[model samples]
Target: MPFLGLQRQLGIDLDSWLLRQSAAQPHGKAGACHAFEREWVECGHGLGQTRARRECQPEYEDFMECMHRTKLAARLKKILDQRDKMIKEGKYTPPDYQKSQEEPRP
Candidate 1:
């Protein structure tokens, strides 16, 4: 409530303010991709709109990959496959889960 009043007094839109704040902090929901995001921002910071797109291509691609989680998904899939293999070989024992009677069926 107080923040809303302050924003009104400062003539700042809440949505744009939140966007600026998120842009300032790279290590947000993007997690390990912060480095890529930071690099892309830095690369494109002062360049003109046209030049930035041309010069920051690599950084942009890296940032996009980080944002899209392509690498993370592959790594997770590999780890999951390894775990499955171990489980099948009886090298890893998974914890047992008991289904509750009160639980609704899907």
Candidate 2:
């Protein structure tokens, strides 16, 4: 295979590994796949660690953003669960089912 293609594959593999290492987050994360392009810019030797780190910045940023969003999703789920529990316990009232009142005309 060509040199750049091999480099690209190496980058992709590294990103995938990083994502799997942190997969506890959630589904929408798309894990590391979301930042493969950024990974491609930064993998391998001779770039100097600092420069490589700069190149990898985009990937790092997206990974954190995905984690934050996933946490938000978890928070929403928690809130919804609490709401449901409250409604069930008569601590709060759920709005009556309104869809049933909408006439379905033949």
Candidate 3:
């Protein structure tokens, strides 16, 4: 591998951003996604199309959706915290559009 190839190995795998199946994840419910991965691997390997087709489409999609939801919630929380800090400093006025969009949904 070339020096440039090492760039890909420099950090955690991008796939790890998805819900971790390991025991270290927070909350009892967090481990549920592990089942999806196991099913995906079994469906692919057992059918002998593991490399030729995506037998785990549903599992992959659901995992991604859950991952996105968690990431988005965290991002929103961070943004809100920043906004609060700015508000306290009297230096930032968040736009009405953002406020309206971010309002808690029912």
The number of the candidate with the highest TM-score is 1
For candidate 1, the 10 contiguous residues with the lowest summed lDDT are 15-24
Candidate 3 versus truth, CA RMSD in Å, comes to 15.3
- Predictions in order: lDDT: 0.70, 0.60, 0.63
- C-alpha root-mean-square deviation, each candidate: 9.6, 9.7, 15.3
User: Each model's TM-score?
Assistant: 0.44, 0.34, 0.32
lDDT of 3 by residue, 1-106 (tens): 1235563778544334543574456664546667776555455554555552566677667666665677678899999899999989999987887666666689
Residue 4 of model 3 has an lDDT of 52
lDDT of 2 by residue, 23-105 (tens): 44476455454555345344624576788677767666665656467767889999989988997899987677832477679
CA lDDT for candidate 1: 0.70
Comparison by TM-score, 2 against 3, better one: 2
Residue 50 alpha-carbon offset, candidate 3, angstroms: 16
The list of candidate 1 runs beyond 4 A from truth reads: 1-38, 45-58, 98-106
Task: After the best TM-score superposition of candidate 2, give how far the Cα of residue 56 lies from its true spot, in angstroms.
Answer: 9.4
**Tens digit of per-residue lDDT, candidate 1, span 1-106:** 1353787898765543433223434444534666776677678777878999999999889888767878889999999899889989999876656323476789
